[model samples]
Target: MTGGGWRRTLPLMPASIPSASRENKKKIPYAWELVGWLWLAYFMNQADRQLYSVVQKQVQEALGLTDIQTGLVNTVLIAAMAVMMPIAGFLGDRLSRRRIILWSLLAWSVATMLTGFTGGLVSLIVIRSLATAVGEAFFVPAATALIGQYHVKTRGQALAFYQTAQYFGAVSCGAAGGWIAGQYGWKHSFWLFGGVGVVLVALMWRRLKDAPKTAAAIACSEPIGDVLRALFRTPTALVLTLALGCSTFVNMGCLAWAPTYLQLEPFNLTPARAGFFSMFYYQLFSFAGVLLGGRVSDKIVGRRPAFRVELSGVSLLLCVPTLYLMGATSTLWVVYAMLGAFGFFRGLYDSNIYASLFDVTAPRYHSSATGLMVGFSFAVGSLAPLALGAIKQSYALHTGISLLGVVYIIGSLALFIAARGFFPSDFLRNQQTVPTSPKL
Candidate 1:
């Protein structure tokens, strides 16, 4: 879906959208000079997002918090992100996504550094919950939207590579955070992470350009409220949002509990070891899943276009069975394989969450819509951890896994329905292509 050849998004910009100026088109697809910095930024984004989770054991013991309490704390963070998204989404539309992303990265890093200074529960909650989510709220929506802007022909593939950095960053950080906790202490990790973000922000500010807006968008600018209303009204957007919410629900639940689960009876691993390994396995598989899913989605979408979404539904179907197996298993290797399989299935849906959205939304609203999804889905999904944690605290890990498996089934159904009914068709929308490709 690059800048040239013959690209049509919808009723908005029907004339064929060409590749970028010959110079851009001529650049190698993975031209390090062009996309390297953005990739680095993506890696950092995941590092920060998952770093705290990686160190959950140390934090829990040191602070003397409950599973539900920690879950509640994370909930606060997600909620903040959710609440900020609509406003940020709106800003991303009217303002600059690149600037918003840079600022967001900077803000969260500062909050991360502040996290190291806290001595008690309240302070940790404030730093990790409010400040962290608030800062992150702006980063993903804007950054992803920005990525989608540049890569069109290979939108699925490009976004996949870009998003792969997130998995790598997180997997690296989760392992690093464990080692840091084991050696220098988690406090130092926070300080170092914060500094790295500050540096990245400075670099991005100089490089990123605003998404190229179409002449039609500028000429036929819709009222902001009207845009918002229309966006919410889009059947595909609504369905995609709910479908994503379900995926996030499973992800959050599994992430929050998997470490603790590993630390339990059969595994009996040390806190640091369990934490590292738990994250290590899932993310390892998730990386492969994401990359493959992106490639698969590209091929499928190229053929059916509706398969852009239907494939995800299929993945969701696969996910439920494996997730059930993941939860019910007691054997370490079995669990690992199941977790990997789950991640693989999940990758298909994760990659398509926004591809489906990009199919329906206007170019100007792309960032805004992305923000809304980032904020709301993340926020809503935050509850999964809290719920699972409470269930673990009350009953057994088995119970929670079983419950989560049920949730996956429900979410899978939603995706199936969306694929069948809500997938936006080029036939129904206009001839113009969505100006922005999808951000993963």
Candidate 2:
């Protein structure tokens, strides 16, 4: 071009750098504004989920529930998560996540607030369980997918930090819920927790815009059938779905029955004391484990991505044993110690879950990929908690907890197989003795 033509356009661009350079330097703005909202939203998500376990006594007394009836309260919530997650997944991949998340936070928070006024199991079933679950379900798919999109190279570390809010909110919610329920009653605690969420929802409404520009941007206006077809066509997506489902089964089963076990065991603690002790130990450890795992995996993946994921497998392997041993042990010190270890490993597994998914799926597929993974994981795993509750009402804690190991092992195995199939060198490079070649 002529010098005059170039000179005229030069004013539009930065004189020091080319247009290409500017585009590269233009930050995506994902982490600072977007991921922050997502992280906090997830934190509140878990805080509400866990607050119930800590305030079980006040809720039970207020409603006059029996053991099975109390068990139904938890089952209702899990069932909501299980049933709603798939539909949430489809919506996340098809609709604007910003809207889905905002509505979700609002719906759940409102339900939680209403839960404070419940007079019976029926109210608990509708408000706390079903409505709350439906709200909670949409956020994770939207939020987690956003995290993966924003923090490409640092997906594990970023998600771990975001997820830490969950542990923080969970652990903090327990301590706070205990105090609130102690002071005002369980009803007040739910009101307080739900109120904070409602305020955050308004804030999210302001900050969160529709990022309809991600994977779903392709057919931004297409029919639902095309999106569904795209999801099933991915091989890595299918494997991840099964792996996560198996992992969640163990988590739900233990979460539901463990408290009842602790309350009745040689430990023989009251519901309130048991609440403080169990949530304190496990969530605290889970907090530490997740933080540590994220950092460790980040370090490991710098040299090798596959190695980082396989390192996460060690957490599950350790978790199964530690959880079982914790339940078996009678001493408070021993129980706490083992519980801490279990939490650490559990964090390790969770920290790497979507990071592993990111490693296999390309960046464009982040939402739909996680949608598939989250859908099957929660849906399939939802059965475990209900089953465990029934078992606790029928059989020994030993039997129920012991059975959970089977599911945990299966999760580890599915991941192990996937790792072996594609990245066998990772485990060998890692501490595990996994072979260097795929058998097939």
Candidate 3:
């Protein structure tokens, strides 16, 4: 079917129809240039967010806020991101992806810089949560979609490279934020990271360029209603969205509170040590996992179309025991090993999360689909910080963290069901094109 015909029958068509119908463009080396800078952008993306968690103790003390309030700060940031996901996705489909990303980086950088000057809760909420999150929300859908456009054959590896920046950013910021806060002050940590981000904005503006348009890009400009209608109708997409929500629930809760947990009771580590331990062990192994999973998936995807979702499910199931033991055990060595194991599985899961979504989604609707999924996931998952915070207040931090295992279990089950049942049909559907009637 022609692109125009597919538009009319979009509800029945699979996501890859647009791209598959288009003539293959010559593979461009510019793909490398694109992912390179995007890696940096994502690094800053996560680092800026993770800083709040590392410095939450000091922020609470200085601001005279409670645990719930600290959680509220993260809640607000995530909520802002969630609210903007659809808007971001729509714009990404229509606008210059490079320009969207540059502006996003600039907006978030400015917000991060202003975060240094906050006087109280109101200022923090305005600068750190609202403004910064709005900027950050514009990034992922556009950037990921753009990368997909460039590296059709190398999608997994390119995305895996992008995923590594997340691990490094979280680890570095979590550790560095603690030390910076201890010595120079928490405000200075914001100033330092924010300043670097601003400098990168100038660099990205000069370096980054969007991919040349193709049938997929042209087709992607469909109205928002059409995009959403098609996306919502796909069972695989819906399942993945719920699965992502479950992943985020565990991730957001742990990222916000793990350092604080380590600083208390049995271990009693200093802020810097707690920060390092909380992220370093897990992310380090996660770093390796992305590399391993990406290569493995790329090699096997042709033979096993459902491998991405299957891998995600298996990884999450593996995380269940590790997450439970990480909190239940008092042995630091046991905790550390479990954290690494958890990170490995998570890395394996993370490597393919979006790639799996892309498999079932049309290239034209990539950004919008990403936005809907991310927005929904983040909105639902935003409750994690507050929910876990409240749980911690009522019970032990270990118990709060242990409860995350249950979320992982549910997510794992969803993915497994999708992998076994939904993926084959959906993937095969993308390969089938329905013919449109001749013009009257």
Candidate 4:
């Protein structure tokens, strides 16, 4: 359908649509440039997040912390992010997203540097958890929404490229952080990564620009309550949020503990080796999967939007066995193989996450919906680390990890339902309500 046809179908369509769409079409080069900068920012974001996990043992020994205390550090940070994301999302719609992105980068970079000075659990919670979380929380809703505005046809590919930073950052930090902590102490690792982030902020300040928004766009901004209500009312969005939560739960638990797990008994690997191996194989395969999944989804989604959600569902289903086997196996090689498989499936789902979400949501509410989806997911995910720590005290770490497969089962089922029962109507409504742009 034509753009005018779409606008006519929805009485509430914002008047800013045509001008905004035209501006996006003309700025395609700048859009890719924007992704290039955001890529580096996101790399640092994931790297900072994984730094403590890679050096967990060293930090624990230095601070005299137990397993649960270590777990609480990650839990607190994620919980803080959960609490702040909705507010950030709301602001992203009304405020200048460029400023929000830059300020968030500055705040988090400063927090990361200060994390090196933490003396105990309280200080860690204060700097790493609360301070960093607040900054990081503002980033994604703005960044992703901004990207969505610039690249309509290539949304999956653009986002997939962006998502690769998460894997690369985690892997780099896991390997480098362990070596740094092992040789120079964990404090030095934090200082190094944090400094890089600070420098990056200074460099990106003048380059990034927000999508053009007219007076009508500003006038039509929805309240937080209305945004929340709209997101929850969309069945596909609700299902996608639940799926994200399930995957995040597994990811948080595993990323936080896998390095430590490999250091124990049968593996008996050095901290550096453990960190490298735990992240390397999985993320390597995930890198490949995301690239392939993104290309495939973008090609097919024009004719079959439901296939995007279906792909995510199928990927999660494939992940169940691999996830279980990765935790259950005692053999190092088998564990590595399972990790690779699990990561590949995870990449498939990750590649289309926001692309799929955007399919069912109107353009105006993209940031708010992203915030609601991510906030709820993180809130659900925040319990993983704490729950695993308790399980470690009561049973075994591997046992807890194996049980995460059940979460994936629930998640896959939810996505399948959304794909089969809800996505068709939701996608159709979205296309009808928003100005039709290039196909994703």
Tens-digit per-residue lDDT, 1-440, candidate 3: 11232121222222332342243453534567688899999999999989999988888999998889889999999998999987898889998998999999989988998998887898899899999999999999999998887766578889998999999999999888889998999999999999999999998887798776655555365677888888887889999999898888899998899899888889898989988899999999999999899889888776677788899999899999898998999988888898899999999999997888888877788889888889988998789999988988888888988889999999999998988778776766654532222222
Candidate 4's residue-wise lDDT over 150-173, tens digit each? 777778999998999999999999
After best superposition, candidate 3 residue 302: deviation in angstroms?
0.4
Candidate 4 C-alpha error for residue 398, in Å = 1.0
lDDT of each: 0.71, 0.69, 0.85, 0.86
Q: List the residue pairs that clash in candidate 2.
A: none
- Greater-lDDT candidate between 1 and 3: 3
**TM of each candidate vs. truth:** 0.89, 0.83, 0.91, 0.92
Positional deviation of 412 in candidate 3, in angstroms? 0.9
Q: List the residue pairs that clash in candidate 4.
A: none
In angstroms, the error of model 3 at 306 is: 0.7
- Relative to the true structure, candidate 2 reaches a TM of 0.83
Which stretches in model 1 have alpha-carbon errors above 4 Å?
1-35, 216-221, 424-427, 430-440
State which candidate, 1 or 4, has the greater lDDT. 4
Task: Using TM-score, rank the candidates from best to worst.
Answer: 4, 3, 1, 2
Q: Count the backbone clashes (under 3 Å) in each candidate.
A: 21, 0, 1, 0
lDDT (C-alpha) at residue 21 in model 2: 45
- Whole-model lDDT, model 1: 0.71
What residue pairs clash in candidate 3, if any at all? 15-362
Which lDDT value does model 4 have at 363?
72
The model with the greatest TM-score is 4
